[model samples]
Target: MEYREVELPACKSIALIAHDNRKASLVAWCARHREALAQHRLCATGTSGALVAEDTGLVIERLVSGPLGGDQQVGALIAEGKVDLLIFFWDPFEPMPHDPDVKALLRIAAVWNIPVACNESSADFIVASPLFAGRSQRMVPDYERYTASRSAR
Candidate 1:
């Protein structure tokens, strides 16, 4: 496996997400953490972004709704190294129509070695960590080498 070091800047690009049932909690959390979160760039699916933005007054780049490929859009951002962290307030109990897309987004985050907060507690830990406002090194996929190896076969 190939790997490379990627640095997450002091000001990060964070993604916010929440299932419909948990949207309220996510919005509340955004409000509570507004001071800390305000220093970073934020993005989220359409409805979630709007709610969080309304509550926290923080600007967020809105993508399509998750069921309408928003998760994939976020995954694309992660893949392209545009997003540094993912704050997903997912409801574990729900069976979503776009379950595969959600999984794909989480999987891509893991592949990219970005910090992903699946719940409020996890989000708290990530935000409270020193790396939130400083550089943190993570190993990312060396896709170029992988592609070259595949092409040689």
Candidate 2:
């Protein structure tokens, strides 16, 4: 696929998601980074968002629960260039009924060339990165070019 460069603004739109078993971990992580997170926009699956907001007092845009299509919602936002980062705290030991949705969300984040942190350690590194503080550039699929090429086939 053809790709083009895009700039992520200084204030990014971050998406948060967590499986049932990992919700507390995600909330604690948010509380730990509350100050840095406050500077950016946060959105999360329904339950996770509410927990984080209640624990850290950070404003969050809540979407439907993950099992109920919240992962797809965040994926759509990523595809639309509205979400810059994805922080998902999913449990690997436990099988999830909504595993497909989780996979799709991660796939979309990769396709969009956005950063994703799947655990607390990665989340810490992501938030502490120098690029996290300012504008950063990333290459993403050039959908229009891809469409035109397909049309020429």
Candidate 3:
């Protein structure tokens, strides 16, 4: 008899990024995990977001393209704890002019303790984790409260 393990889907705000050449792979991966990913909020760079959104029929909050600061925008979200996970499919074989931005975004994710997936395998590991039990990360202590408290001090 074969044993089957069940992975609890976690509700996570995820950022999806891919280079132009890898958009197709990203889309395919998203399609395979659409059911799980759909339970969470999706944010993506313009082109990758469009591709994933189209492929999975899931709504993605789109940001500017990577070269146009989309990576920074998502990085800010991670820094503020707005995002839970990041899946970036970069073409390491090819050098990108926007490499700095990519590195910055990746660095920010690390600083914020956000999980990142640079390939399909890593993505599978994340989506299959017990922590991801189809539960959303609480957004407590709203931004307004934090800002107000800081101002009072």
**Which predicted model would earn the best TM-score?**
2
Clashes (backbone N, CA, C under 3 Å), per candidate, total: 0, 0, 7
Residue-wise lDDT of candidate 2 within 1-153, one digit each (tens)?
999999999999999999998999999999999999999999999999999999999999999999999999999999999999999999999998999998999999999999999999999999999999799999999999999999999
Ranking by lDDT: 2, 1, 3
What stretches of model 1 exceed 4 Å from their correct place? none
TM-score of structure candidate 2? 0.98
Enumerate residue pairs that collide in model 2: none
Task: Give the TM-score (vs. native) of candidate 1.
Answer: 0.97
TM-score per candidate, chains pooled: 0.97, 0.98, 0.81
- Which structure among the candidates has the greatest lDDT? 2
In order of TM-score, best first, we have: 2, 1, 3
Model 1 has an lDDT value of 0.93
Weakest ten-residue segment in model 2 by summed lDDT: 96-105
> What local lDDT score does residue 135 receive in model 1, on the 0 to 100 scale?
84
Q: What lDDT would each prediction earn against the true structure?
A: 0.93, 0.96, 0.82
Give Cα distance to truth, residue 72, candidate 2, Å: 0.5
**If both were scored by lDDT, which would come out higher, candidate 1 or candidate 3?**
1
